[model samples]
Target: MAARSGRRRAIRGWLGKACTVIAAAVLVSSVGAAAAPAAPIHAPVLRAPAGGYEELWVPSSMGPIKIQVQWAARGGGAALYVLDGLRAPNDHSQWTSDTDALRQFANDNVTLVFPVGGRSSFYTDWYRSSSTNRQPITYKWETFLTRELPDFLAGYGVSRTNKAIVGASMGGNAALVLAAHHRDQFRFAGSFSGFVNPTFPMWNQAMRAAMWDEGQFNVDDMWGPAGDPAWSRNDATAQAERLRGLPMYVSSGNGMPGPPDLPYGAVNTVNAMALEAMTMTAAQIFRDRVAALGIGARIEIGNGTHTWPYWRQGLANARPMILDALGAH
Candidate 1:
């Protein structure tokens, strides 16, 4: 009997140890659960003075998109979206850096909206991930610009419908595409030194080289193979009929240096000359297509290169048209 009692006490001792271990495990789990970090909360931070140049962090599916904005001088509702070239920087826009865009539009009674960062993206939605390199997320720029951005801007008294878009180089093509597709959003569209005819023979090759040079991005990842319908869809020349009744401005250089290239070195000037020549040819083709469709657009071809001075002048020339289209003084 005493032995039986001893065995029972031994089993109790084992049960007590097991319970203690289980209790310690539960305590540790509870402590760990309490110690876990919480999910981060994101909020938009505004920088710069009121009614002047301001930076806004807008939320999107890809991530937060930085938008540099110059508010209308007299509280006007009209806004102008200025897009950057192929090698757009992440922190700020080239428009603000290269030109006096902020001061030029400070009293224009039109808000200037510059979307920062889109290197080699062409500001379009991609078919898949970047083939040449790994991207953190699939680019959904079309949706962001057309839907998310406009929705956000509407809250700050900027009209979603009354807006103008202008771009230089790669951005110029994207502006035309966006205006052609979303006519209701834009009343005026301008392209300065853009390869508007992307589907042309050897044009895809040129684009592939440029994209690769800028960010090692694969052109195939943008809209699939060269013959894909997306290529034709994004081509401004191919979609010229859609731009009917829309006031538009198109300009390119004649491969020769004008006053702007005088300050640049020989190599820079030569490169600009070659690029401008190619873009001019494509712009001419696009102009012919628009004319054939009875679409009246302001086309300017002059002696200059693919440098920023000409583009800055182009913007200045188009400012009056933009204000008139948006009725923004």
Candidate 2:
């Protein structure tokens, strides 16, 4: 584990430099430091929220990755993946700071994995590059959490199976993508105030209008650039057809454009003003596509914006669903 820490630190040291890429300049101006931090990130806490530990995960290909985990020490087993929204922080995210959701969920003895690093990788494995095209972002996360993280958890006496994946915004998409690709490991998936669409035109269709801001990063760069086949493969909503028994949770709010239904509140409002409308609309349409799926899932249009408070509020609807799934264990 110490070795893992060393490797993760090394990766972040390099990533801190590459965070100034052209795509970041275009994709999000407010997220300037999302890609800047090295691990051991600080959360502006009035006080520590409960108890948790931080660990570094190292994959053969990705080198080292920082993952902060929280869990109840005494109870049955469950694994939950908490993804960082765009502009992620290392120690804690809106996922923990914005609400009491973690208190409710962790009380049930679920293991929470928070992956912190908000580069262009989008938490996916790059198709042609193993850190080739992008030097700092090797994009080897697919293996680190999926293969090595779980093994590391077992060492800590954590649950190895009955995993549930969940997150908001980009993290939500990542949770879905991870679970969809590894159904054998992830029995349940959820996205709160999630960006649910991968193919903007094919599904939400609104993103094309709202997504061009900052430096104008084409979503394809995060997936595979335009005309690339990998885009088809990673489309989150498209993966729905392949999710036979896997249950899903997805939602989008009003902060995106005109509606004003951001789940979190202040943060969402700030983001709305700070971000380009194209980005918000893109996320909204993605959620709409999830609702369109009409699968054995839950998708809602809420009253708030995309702030942590709103997402925390949405959890009232989302929590039971996730717990019910985890209870299956």
Candidate 3:
């Protein structure tokens, strides 16, 4: 009987040891599961279709400004900022609407950026809101383009410093003004049928008339008055010396009907001709001023008019120089 009790005690001890071992194993597994690392979360990519453009709402002090962006074909970091004219629409840039800009740069290794909506604002930071039209927001495009937009673009692999700017008509002068002041941002600047010299005689009146006709925006709201220093500050010709080291392309038509102008009706063609003539005069003044300052710019004067086709051709002509300046393939 004593031998039997001893065997039972021995079995009970073995059972206790087995249960402890199993409990320890289960605890280790629970601790291991709790210590495992989790999967990481990633930010959404800011990209477009394979060969198309995407609309990105970039934040700015002026509000959330919408910009149309086409990523580089070969994954380049350089960008080309295409500015719109005085009659710029709020929906999209005229560059995308009127010209074959997308197809032209589809295979190129440079990101294309088109800033939308700044009709008759001259793409400049206005001194005050327009009193005539009671504009809701004070225009602050200069700050948005130079500072806010660049900072936002840096996160998307686009170089803030390596860039080019081009514009037709109103945007043309604004491009030069931006390049002249912010040399660190733009490597190249181009003006196609742009009114580069706003301080020229009778030009301010022309601008005033054009602004009123387009958007009822008073010119006084833009630069304060006709004799304000802001006029000279914004004038590309007045700031010619500032553009000394920058590569520039300036082109204008002689107000004559070119091959591109043949498709339009008589009134439209005549209007384009008149506008081109005036813009050409301003462009020439800017060119002469730059020349006097010993600044070399590719100045092309040919037969065309202030129309999309001519500006499209101008962009095509400036493509090689622009690509070279930006170090794009």
Candidate 4:
């Protein structure tokens, strides 16, 4: 009888210890759940474009932005970010709408990232919410592209550590500014007909005029009144010394008629001529600054204007150089 009683007590003691262990595990799990980081923002694929390209809606601090990504065939290496011009459309990147970049890089081993929108905003973080052509504008592009987008991309096996960026016109300036500010992120940068100097006298007014022509935006709201440090901070020419060790390509046309501009009644030819003239001056200044800094860069002065064909040709010329920098072949 005594043996049976002792066995029952021993079983009860074992059960009590097991219960205590279970309670301790539950407490630790609750504490961990409370301390963990917030869940990542979900980015769903919006659609598959014609050339095996997938467009995704990426959540950002500004809002949900649409980005088209063409993954590399082998799915590894640095990514190339292609930015648009001053009159960037809200729907898609001009790299797709105007040029054959998607088709050209379809089989390459480096992912091509094209971010849409940011018309006349220069892809920079603005001072405050403002209006353009009576439409409310809120821009946080620098933060989104440099911070949020990369974090999101890292989830999909894309290496955020290595990147190359190229831009045309306003995007070109933005690319230089981004590379200068975030040197560890981008190793190669290119600019085609970009207005590299915004702080020069009367240059701010010219930019204001261009912005007004594009979207009737108030230039004062972009960076502040003329002579603001923001202008100098974002000027590619001003920051040339910072780009000394990086690989770069700078190209611009001489504001003349090229093969594509010689077409039948090309109305945009005159606009290209004038626009390229303005950008050419700034580009030359940028080239000289880069040279003064002893940076070895490929600078091309072509016999074309600020047309799509000229920019497309610039991209074609820069492709091998960019691939070489990214080790993409």
TM-score for all models, in order of appearance: 0.84, 0.68, 0.85, 0.83
* Candidate number of the best TM-score: 3
Please say which candidate is ahead in lDDT: 1 or 4.
Answer: 1
Give lDDT tens digits, candidate 1, residues 46-139. Answer: 2234434666788898899988787777777789999987767676676776666666676677888989888778889998878787777778
User: lDDT values of the candidates?
Assistant: 0.74, 0.51, 0.75, 0.70
Question: TM-score of predicted model 3?
Answer: 0.85
Candidate 1: give the clashing pairs. Answer: none
Top model number, lDDT = 3
Ranking by TM-score: 3, 1, 4, 2
> What stretches of model 2 exceed 4 Å from their correct place?
1-60, 90-94, 128-134, 202-221, 256-294
Cα RMSDs of all predictions? 21.9, 9.7, 27.3, 23.4
Q: Which stretches of candidate 1 lie over 4 Å from their true place?
A: 1-52
Give the per-residue lDDT of model 3 (tens digit) for 180-267: 9999999999998888998877677777766766667888988978789999999999999999999999999997896776655566
Q: Per-residue error at 82 for model 2, in Å?
A: 0.4
**Separate clash counts for every candidate:** 0, 23, 0, 0
lDDT of 4 by residue, 208-305 (tens): 66566555676778798887898888899899888888889889888777677654134445556656776788888887887887878888886776
